[model samples]
Target: MKTTKRLDLAIQKLYTAFHNNTLNPECCKQCAVGNILDHTDAWKHLSDNHGSTTLNYIGMVNQKFGKTFNGYSPLELLHIEAQFLKACGYQLPLHHNNKKPKNPTDKEVLFLGLSAVVQFLCKLDNMPDVMDCNQLFQFQPQIKTSKALMLS
Candidate 1:
């Protein structure tokens, strides 16, 4: 299957699970295919605290595709999502710290992340860049983290 199609299917599965309250760790493992958590605390928090099913799915996707998911906290996942989004040409509104805000509410962050992934895939396919924020959007982009940030 095409990568985009696969991503869409995964997202749909996640949403179905969430709406049905079937987002337990076991369910996630079966549906998300590389989710790291053994239980549904992350999903629970995502539902109760964050508002976007898309963000929850992004977390699941990162666990599956990004090797960093094993020991990551939820906040870390948000940061990774932000970095991923920025790489795809979304000019993230900077927080007061001149960085993307930490631990964004799921509603505030999920669509941006999903859009980023779509954008990245478009870049991979050599499509014309559609994002309007950064010049880097025109090229094959990489997520960049400073050494200090990485060490923190």
Candidate 2:
């Protein structure tokens, strides 16, 4: 399968799992992947309790990919957040502390997971640049739009 198709499949799987409540956040909570996915919502990154867990995922991804993120700079965290925002179809704010809209839809969560998977695949495939890594998003298919969902 093409990389885009493969990644899209993974995103769909994640979407199903999330809607089915099949993913256990416990699996990645302390690790970087877990920190971002398991912890935050659409609007926020730094939890007063969690305090910007992006660094954790950075170290983990770097370790897994044999790349180094150095984990200490706020700029590095912003960079990762940029990728995630793109994947989530969100816009980057001028202020790092600004929050996004609350009550993220299932699609949002899955796309976020897709973002992480893309990062992981990039590491695994040794294709780290944005142009290369972004191909993972070429086939991103939304299972359902908000209009189809019954909002309470």
Candidate 3:
């Protein structure tokens, strides 16, 4: 999956976060979206420097990538977070106000998650855009069965 330069950087960071097990309330509270949106690019006008909100970014995504995310929204993200957190038996810490001062829209949260997801899946499968095929992880069992197989 392709993305604008800044979004790509953000997606790559999210990819790294996943591998490093760094997804947490702190990062989410911080610039989860801002991490990429704040970058500088002379040719690009979509950066946060332009006073664009998360909704603006989402609209840009829909514009750039077509309507693949037309039906996806922030409610979907809240529910996804709730269900996944519940299944994992982890609970988000309680705060008087959980949202950050620059609270991102639900759609923005979903977009952030999705960008991470796409980069993650691409990394896992060695998709041409994000990872080298040789770097793909080789499961232990699969390694035992395949010749010249070892940890990626």
Q: Name the Cα RMSD for model 3.
A: 12.0
Which ranges in model 2 have alpha carbons more than 4 Å from their true place?
A: 1-32, 35-82, 89-99, 112-120, 127-152
lDDT tens per residue, model 2, 1-152: 33454334434545555565554322223222333333334213332222233434444455456543222233343444444444444444423364543433445554564556456544444545333433567655557777787653
lDDT of 3 by residue, 7-59 (tens): 35545764554455444422332223323223212212222322222334644
Evaluate model 3: give its TM-score.
0.26
Arranged by TM-score with the best first, the candidates are: 2, 1, 3
Q: In model 1, which runs have C-alpha deviations exceeding 4 angstroms?
A: 1-4, 10-98, 125-152
Candidate 3 — what's its lDDT? 0.37
Best by TM-score: 2
The candidate that achieves the highest lDDT relative to the unseen native structure: 2
Model 1 TM-score relative to the real fold: 0.27
TM-score of each: 0.27, 0.31, 0.26
lDDT tens per residue, model 1, 4-109: 4433443454455445544322122322222223333344332222222234654565555753334444444344334444532334433243444254324334
Instruction: Estimate candidate 2's alpha-carbon lDDT, on a 0 to 1 scale.
Output: 0.42
Ranking by lDDT: 2, 1, 3
Worst 10 residues of 1 by lDDT: 25-34
